[model samples]
Target chain A: MPTQILYKPLTPEQEKRRRQRNIAIALSVAALVAIFYAITLVRLGSNVFLRPD
Target chain B: MSLVSESDLGQQSDFGSAASDASPSDYVALLKPRVMSLSIFTAFAGMLMAPHPVHPMIGAIALLAIAVGAGASGALNMWYDSDIDRLMARTANRPIPAGRMARGEALAFGLVLSAFAVLTLGLAANWLAGGLLAFTIFYYVVVYTMWLKRSTPQNIVIGGAAGALPPMVGYAAAAGSLDLSSLLLFTLIFVWTPPHFWSLALVKAGDYGRAGVPMAPNVWGPDATRLQILLYSLLLAPIGALPWILGYAGPVYGAIACLGGLGMILGGWAVFSRREGDLARKTAMRNFGFSILYLFTLFAVLVVERLTTIWLGA
Candidate 1:
C-alpha cells in the first residue's frame, strides 16, 4: 500500500497560480518536444535509412 | 496592497530562502551526476561510432554540454516535482524539497544552466549538436516532466526520446550529420527505456502513487507493467545488437551486446514470472541495476574496439 501525503489544499487563487505554473511547465516541455520532433523531421529529409527499406 | 500582480505573489510564495554560496557539492549535485554519467557514456558511443575526426578539446566540450544539459533537465525536474518530491522518501532529501533550496531558485538555476549548455554547445560545436542538446534538455523538462508524468501511464515510454538524444548529439558533434549507426544506437536506448524505468517504478510505486504521479504500476497495475517490462526487454536484445549487425563494431562489441541485452531480457522475464515477494523484487532490482551496467559495457566496448583498431593501425 502507498502512503498518501496531504498537500495544503490551496485557496482558489493559489490553485489558479499552481495551474498557471503547470501550464508553463507543460508549454516548456512541449516546446522542447516540438524542437526535437522538428529536428527529426528535418533530419528525415536526409535520413534515407529511416526511409522505406 | 493594490499594485503587486498575482503572478508576482505566486512567485514570491514559491521562492524559498536563498541558498548559501552554492556549495561545491551542491553544484556537482546540480549536474545530476548519475544521469550525466549515463549521458556521457552514450555521447562517447555516438562520437566513437561516427566517422570523422574531432579535436579532443571540442570533444571534451561536447561531453560537457551533454552533461550540463542533463543536469539542467534534472534541476528543472526537481523544481517542478518539488511538491510531490516532498512526499516520496526516495526523493525527499534532494536539495530542493529538503528545504535546503527554494523551488523558484531551483527552477531559475535550471533554466539558466539549460540555456548555457545549449548556447555553449552551439558555439563550441556545430549548431546541429547544439540544437540536439537543446532539444534533449527541453524533451526531458517538458515532455517527460510536465506532459507524460501525471497525465498518462505511458510517460516513460514517450518521454524517453530526450534520454535517447545524447548519442545523436555525440554523433552530430563528431560527424556533423546523421547516419544509420547513430540512429540505430538511438533506437537501442529508446527501446530500453521502459524496462529500465519500470523496474524502479515497480519498487517505488508507493512513492510515485503517493505523489500523484501516474507511474505504470499506479495507473495500469503491477501485472500489466511487469508484462510491458518483459516486452521491451525482448525488443532490447536485437536493437542493442545493431552496431555489430551494421558492421560499425567488431566481434568483441557484438558478442557483448548480444549477451548483455539477452541477459537483461532473461533477468526481466524471470522477475516477471516470479511470485511477488522479496525474491521477485530482488530479481527486478538486479535486472534494473544490471541494465545500467549493460548499457555502459555495451558502449564502453565501442570505445575500446575503436582504440584497438587505431593502436594496431587497422
Candidate 2:
C-alpha cells in the first residue's frame, strides 16, 4: 500500500516569504533575458560578422 | 463531491498545501549553486585561455547557458538521489529530501532548464558548446547519478568526466572548436577528481556504506584508497605543471602550480601515513580542503596570467 503522508499549511509569515521569493526569482529571470537581448542588439549594431583585414 | 469521504478531503488538502510550501529559494537550492559556480569559473578560464576572441556579450551568454545546464544536472541528480541523499546527513536537508520541493517538480524543472540552456547556447554560440552541455547533463544524470553511483566503486572515476567537461565546452564556445590546451584542462580536472573526492569519501565512508553506495573506502579498504589517492596525487602533480611546460602559462603560473602540486602531495602523504581513527579523519579532511584550494589557485593563476598577457599585449 502507498504511504499516507500528512502536510502542514504554511504560517502567514512563511507564506509571505514564499511570495516574496517567487517575485524575486521572476524579476531576476526577466533581468537576465533583458540583458541578453540588449547585448544581442549591441552585437548586431557593431557588425559582428565583419572582419578587419 | 457528495460521495467523497473525510479522509479523501484531507488527502486533497494536504496535496494542495504541499505546492504552496515550496519557496523560490527552495527551487534555487535545487540548482546546486556552488557546483554551478565552480563549473562557471572553470568554463570562464577555458574561454579566456582560447586563442580566439569572443564578444563580451556572447561570452556572458555562453557562461549563463553553461551555468544553467550545470544547475539542471544538479536538480536531476538530486531528484534521483533523494533516497540516498536522505540517508546521508550532509545531504538530508536538501530541498527535495526535506520536502520543500516535490521530486516531480524538480524533475520537470531540470528537464526544462536543460532544454532551454542547450537551445539558447546553440543559438548564441555554436552547436559544439551546446552539444557538449547537453551531453554533460545526460552524463551526470543518467550515467553518474542513476547508473554508476549505485553500481560500482569506480563511480566517481567515471562520473568525474561530467564535471571535467565544462572547460572544454567553454573553449568550444569561444574558439568554435577544441584543441590540445582544452584537452589538457579537461585532463587536469579529470586526474584531480579522484584525490579530491576520495578524501571526502574516506570521512563519509560510513554514511555511504549505510546508504549502500560503493564508495572507494567502502569497496576497497581505507588503506588501499589512501594509497590510490597518493598515486593519483603523484600523477596530478606533474600534470598540473604541463601548461607551463607546454608554453601556455607564464613563470608565475608555473611557480604556483609547483607549490600547489607539492601541497596536494603533502596532503595525500598525510592521509596515507595516518590511518587510525580521529587522526585519519582529520588528515582526510585536510586533503579534501587542500585539494579545493589547489584547483582554485591553479585556475586563478591561469586567469591572472592571461589577463596580464592581454593587458601587456605580449
| Residue pairs that clash (backbone atoms under 3 angstroms), model 2 | none
Q: Which ranges of candidate 1 are over 4 A from the true structure?
A: A1-53, B1-13, B16-22
- Weakest ten-residue segment in model 1 chain B by summed lDDT: B16-25
* Stretches of candidate 2 exceeding 4 Å from the true structure: A1-14, A46-53, B2-18
Q: What digit string (tens of lDDT, one per residue) describes model 1 on residues B136-253? A: 8888988899888889988899998889989999999888898998898889899988999998888888999889999999988988988999999998998988879989889998
Chain B TM-score per candidate, please: 0.92, 0.95
Q: How big is the positional error of residue B252 in model 2, measured in Å on the Cα after superposition?
A: 1.1
Q: Write the per-residue lDDT of candidate 2 for residues B101-138, one digit (tens) a residue.
A: 66777888899889989987887888999999999999
TM-score of chain A of each: 0.61, 0.73
Q: What is the interface RMSD of each candidate, in Å?
A: 16.2, 7.3
What docking class should model 2 receive?
incorrect
Candidate 2 per-residue lDDT over residues A1-53, each given as its tens digit: 43443444557876886787678768978976886686577558768777889
